[model samples]
Target: MKVEGIAAIVTGGASGLGLATAQALAGAGAKVALVDLNEQGAKAAAEPLGGIGIGCDVSDAASAEAAVARAAEAHGPARILINCAGVATPGRIVGKNGPLDLSVYSRVIAINLIGTFNMMRLVAAAAQSLDPLDGGERGVIVSTASVAAYEGQVGQAAYASSKAGIVGLTLPAAREFAPVGIRVCAIAPGIFETPMLLGLPQDVQDSLGRSVPFPSRLGKPEEYADLVMSIIRNPMLNGETIRLDGAIRMQPR
Candidate 1:
């Protein structure tokens, strides 16, 4: 996990938290692979990082497999896999217009929940085959959830459920991978100044930031990357979902 000369794969690496993580990993001398649905965006993001950019749909098993394969071909078997590919679709099971669209709910789950799992399993399989590094650590896998998983506000049924599934998955995955010297951890972030949150009105974004207890501001993508670096360094921190929420428990909206 020193990162120097190691291979890493960062999903959703074209933008936001994943992009920041990719930058951090590359800066730390890791051979990085940037995977995203937006091939052009991935290319742009990977160019300066000196990492390979791979077009991938995390929800598709074949796509995930191929992406992992290509990354291995380019950078050797990856020992660090970060799962940041997710979609945030806000919807209520029962809305003002009655029941919500079933398709919307399904799509959110497919992209956010299943997509994380698809990439994790595929990447972990590849990592498992690699020989252990220092401290018998073969690899580390970091995934992204959301504070919504714990304190979902109104109209966050689909999004919250998908994130909660990710939170639930961490411990089991870590436990399962323990024998292989692989670690699985997740970060449940609060409101951050990513494209998703920034899309809201400025006032809305300001209010959301103020909701955080101490910082009273939104998180930066680089801050998320810093915690990821810590997780990579500290081998004891496994099977846990650390909240990067700055002490915010969302209120019912």
Candidate 2:
């Protein structure tokens, strides 16, 4: 679907990759909605872009529904749904303090895996009702996976599993939405210069950057946005999880 004049929603839009995508969509003339747990920050982020910002817990049915409803009221139902809301609370399944707490594992799954699905189902439902666009396409959904899903290092069991769920979800979701002319795809990014990572010491960040075989630096949020824009523009791309890593396969740490 064309980004210009289309409605788009990006979760985790307060900062990081989500924000970058929202920026790109807005720049492309899409009516954008920024959704995040940080309500104030989301509002601020969306204001300059002429988009609306909403506070929502992507894991909760009621909250997500309300958020989607609000976005529809403001900019019509979103045809482009980008799933970037997630938590990366690293923890081992078995740790020095015995098994990791059940809460830790459950929280990660709830927010990262279930959250992506929650937004997808709602957005796809809305998009399906709209008349097909050029090329019979109704909508597009691009979610964020992680290279950790394939090569999860130590202390990432929960994070890895949640991302793996995203990878597993791609093909099935694309097949299910095929009849409706809605495309589903995902991007599995490696180490990137997200706000979470930026908080680390400069030397530590540099060391992490050096680990990548080429470019030898952290991926930029804007680079990820470029990939999303490409996927949205290409109708032939569907049911696949494309890696945005700098050709780096992580080692078990």
Candidate 3:
């Protein structure tokens, strides 16, 4: 569907992948809404883009509902929903300190997995009521996953499981939304230069970059944004999780 003049909602829009996507969508003439926990940051990011920002906790039902409603009020029903809000707190199921806290696992799942679904469901519900666009498409949803979903390392039990749930949700959602002209897809990024990765030592970051087979560098946020645009433009791409990794199959660390 054409992005120009349509409303788009991006979760985690304060920073990282979500911020990059909000900028891209705004550049394409879409009315962008940045939904994030950092209200100030979201407003700051959305200002130059000429869009609105809302503070939202995606894991909470009421917060997410209110956020989506606020975006619709300002920009109309969202035609594009990008699920980029996630956390990567790594810990083993049974760590040196003994079993990990149950809340820790629940937190990861709540924010990463449940949060994606919360935003998707609410956005799609609104999008379906709108008239179809070019190819009988009412809306499109792009969710974020990780290569860890496939090959999780030692300490990434919770993170991997959360991402795996996203991967799992893509197809069923697409199939269900098909009749409504709403598409669902996902991206499993390998190692990107997100704030979390950048916080590591320089040498460690470089090592991670060198692990990619061909590009031999970390994935750029713009590159991911580019793929999102491609998915939005291509009508046949649905119910699939494309890997944005540069041919990197993560080892079992």
Model 2 Cα lDDT, one tens digit per residue, 52-169: 9999999999999999999999999899999999999998889899999999999999999999999999999999999999899999999999999999999999999999999999
Q: Compare candidates 1 and 2 on lDDT and give the better one.
A: 2
Ranking by lDDT: 2, 3, 1
Q: Give candidate 2 regions above 4 Å deviation.
A: none
Write down the RMSD of all candidates, one decimal each: 0.9, 0.5, 0.6
In lDDT terms, how accurate is model 1? 0.93
Per-residue CA lDDT of model 3 for 1-253, tens digit only, reads 8889999999999999999999999999999999999999999999999999999999999999999999999999999999999999989899899999999999999999999999999999999999988779999999999999999999999999999999999999999999999999999998998989999999999999999997999999999999999999899999999999999998999
Best by lDDT: 2
**Model 1 misplaced regions, further than 4 Å:** none
User: Candidate 3 has which clashing residue pairs, if any?
Assistant: none
Taken over the whole model, the C-alpha lDDT of each candidate is 0.93, 0.97, 0.95
Return the clash pairs for model 1, or none: none
